[model samples]
Target: MTINTTHNCTEPQSNWIFVGVYSMVFMVGLILNLTALVVFFCYTKLWSHTTVYMINLAIADLLLVLTLPLRIYYHLGMHGLSQVLCEGVGLVLLVNMYGSIFLLTCMCFDRCVAVCFPMSCRVREGRKKAPLVCLGVWGLTIGASLPIYISKRSKASKEIQVDRCFGSFPVYATQTTAVASTLTVGFGIPLVVMLVCSWALIHAITRSAVAQTDLINSGKIQRMIATSLVIFLACFLPYHGTLALLYVHREAVPCSLLSVYHYSLMVACLNAILDPLAYYFTTETFRRKVDMDAMTRMFPLNSQNSEGNNSRAPVNT
Candidate 1:
């Protein structure tokens, strides 16, 4: 397999933008996900079927964030990183990206089932298998991403004196197949499932005439679903969309489109930063774990009680 040397054009402006955005995302995502991990592990009461998925999601995001510095180094024109190291980071990135998607999809389905069949015996039984389901997602994402290392054979170029990683994949076959599979499994299927689940959840909530408790629960579910959908759209959709275009066009893809594709990837990285908000709103334990008084003190206001009350506004578990 040969690299598409024609598409190796560099954009310093875009590279700097990536470095800046990734640095910010790394700092924020790392802190938020680590806090979530602490809450999930230390607060034993927070353990539940849903928290299993949340824990795995946090782990995936944390791992993905840990890879950002390497990517930042790569984008900043630093060379000589081994091909194995490059591909390894790429593998982790894809694994977590799809892993988060699958986990979020599972969450949506879980919430939908809970809302639609609140009293079903089968639903209760199904909750017991949440750990197994998460394990399967991990296995599936790892299996899918392993091809990143397998499909490309890197070689050190005498002219450049550095090894090329994914840049060397055969465009028409391996690259095309990878992009197609990524679009289908990573984005297309998950998007469809999430949309269906969201609609069902909304319908179930709206059609039922329920008490204030149920209303609040429904509102929380809607917020979680909406946040997940927004992240999917804003992050994954544009990145994958541009990715497909780049793959289809190959060397003919313009530098401007390439810049857009790179920026879209950075936007996708923002999902790691936004996911903690979903956790904060959707998980009662997380909300309770938050220090409202500390928050009010950190960002001072005239009236601490009022600010604390506003911060503690009701959210569903």
Candidate 2:
């Protein structure tokens, strides 16, 4: 698969829209994710299985946000950067993207099992294995993303007076295989798992009298599920949809479609910005650490405690 360099391509005025969106996402995502990390490490107890997955998810979002400035620089006409640097940034982005996906999937599974089998010894045992699961997720994501670096072969173009990263691939097989694997492993399987877990969790909560009695906790879990579904649909769905389409029409894709692909990628980056909301809604510790008084003042009705309750409760999910 030969990679086409956009170095000589003229930038349309609309390209700046991407730059602007990235800038906003970088700033907001950076602040929110870092604050979540600080709260998780310094304030919240970190021993829970869900907390382990949440910590890893926050770290993944943080790593991805850290790469935005370079991307912004690239978007702002700073071309001719080292191919190795470009590939490294691409690799980090890919790893973090899938890392977030898999971690969220784990979280859904954890919550489902907890809700469905609260007293099961297996749930307790799973807590001991949480760290290993996280380690495995990191390893899997890194291993999968390594192909981005290995398959990308950069070369200096004397005519353009710069080193072009991902200039071209020697074989289409690598590109085709990578895209297929990513669609299945990175998005498809995870999507299915999340949907199943969410359904099971909701069903368990509805059928169990204990879950109905704890309205506040149940509400938080439902919010978390809704947020996860929205993020996947808004961010990953369109982007991967475009990827599949591009793969199908690789030989005759229009420039407008290419532009749509770029926009879809930008939309996907919004996931970093939205993940912090997941932390807030799902993690009671995070909610306690944050200033709920101010949040309540900002959004009074939505933030109100149930039944005019004055006592603030932590999320127990």
Candidate 3:
């Protein structure tokens, strides 16, 4: 089970399974994300802070999914990509991966503000500044990923012939620095902030209905945010954790930690599939669309006008 370090990676028994699973996940993610993009463009009026942020999230998922075909081909056929090509593709995917995480964290924070103190939250609706924020996320992602290009290890090690990819750090210092920075700045801090804010939102939402006008709506949104954060944690924690361990125990690189590392990488790819689900779950408009679809299914002949009147009628009376 000696893991090669160059581009001529030996096909592990698990590589077959990895390719099959990741292929399905990426395809589904691609479709869902594209749908989200269409929704964003076609229904701009329905866009709120959540939906606005979600549009960027969908972009991230789409970009990440786009890179999966290369990976699938490489794994399935043991194709050797040039070092420059591997590094370029890997950097782009890496940016989206972290960009999505950070952006979600930002959205969670924004939602927390809106939920806990709507009067003071002060987020401008329609978010004309959204493009700026997105630009910043991309800039930061590229800035953070610059080290990969500089280090040259992002390309496969010439001696071992196993394409190292992004997480397979060749140098101990570089691996440690990357893992520590990402874990602390990218994941750890964001997770902590989201946990605190989400708990506060829950507390605020559960208070007396009369005391909180938006309690019900806020509760739904908070649950969605919390769930997304939980998925992010579950997916990326193992990948970063094992990578951290790999840094400390470099001797375990290709052989000792290979399986764990590879599995972690697979889980990371699976995030693309789960991320769109998280976005839809966190979005009010998406839920409303789903409810409308369900209603249409339940009453195929009901007119929109009739449904509106029925919705407005007092249920308690």
CA-lDDT, candidates in order: 0.72, 0.71, 0.67
Relative to the true structure, candidate 1 reaches a TM of 0.81
Model 1: per-residue Cα lDDT over 177-274, one tens digit each? 67878889878998999899889988887677772454456576567677778877888898888888778767566666666765776788888988
Q: Which stretches of candidate 1 lie over 4 Å from their true place?
A: 1-7, 154-174, 211-221, 292-316
Candidate 3 per-residue lDDT, tens place, 1-317, comes to 44334222333532677788779978899888886675566434445656667778888989998988877877675545664576677777778888988887777777667766666524545244666777788788778778655765534354454345433443422365677788798778877887887787777767747446743565565566577767888888887787677666564345646567767867887888887777664455554544454445558786563465223111010
Candidate 2: residue 158 lDDT (0-100): 26
Give me the candidate number with maximum lDDT: 1
- TM for every model, in the order presented, reads 0.81, 0.81, 0.77
Candidate 3: 10-residue stretch with minimal lDDT: 308-317
lDDT of 2 by residue, 1-317 (tens): 22244343232533477689989989999988887776666555435777788789889988988888877877776666786686677678768988999998888888778877879997879866988999999999998767554644433322344443323111221268768877899899999998998889778766777776855476766776877887877889988888787676665554565667768777888999898886544455467555544345546695655335344433354
**Pairs clashing within candidate 3:** 5-160, 5-162, 6-160, 6-161, 6-162, 6-163, 7-161
**Shift of residue 182 alpha carbon in model 2, Å:** 0.8
Pairs that collide in candidate 2 are 1-171, 1-172, 2-169, 3-168, 284-315
Clash numbers, per candidate = 0, 5, 7
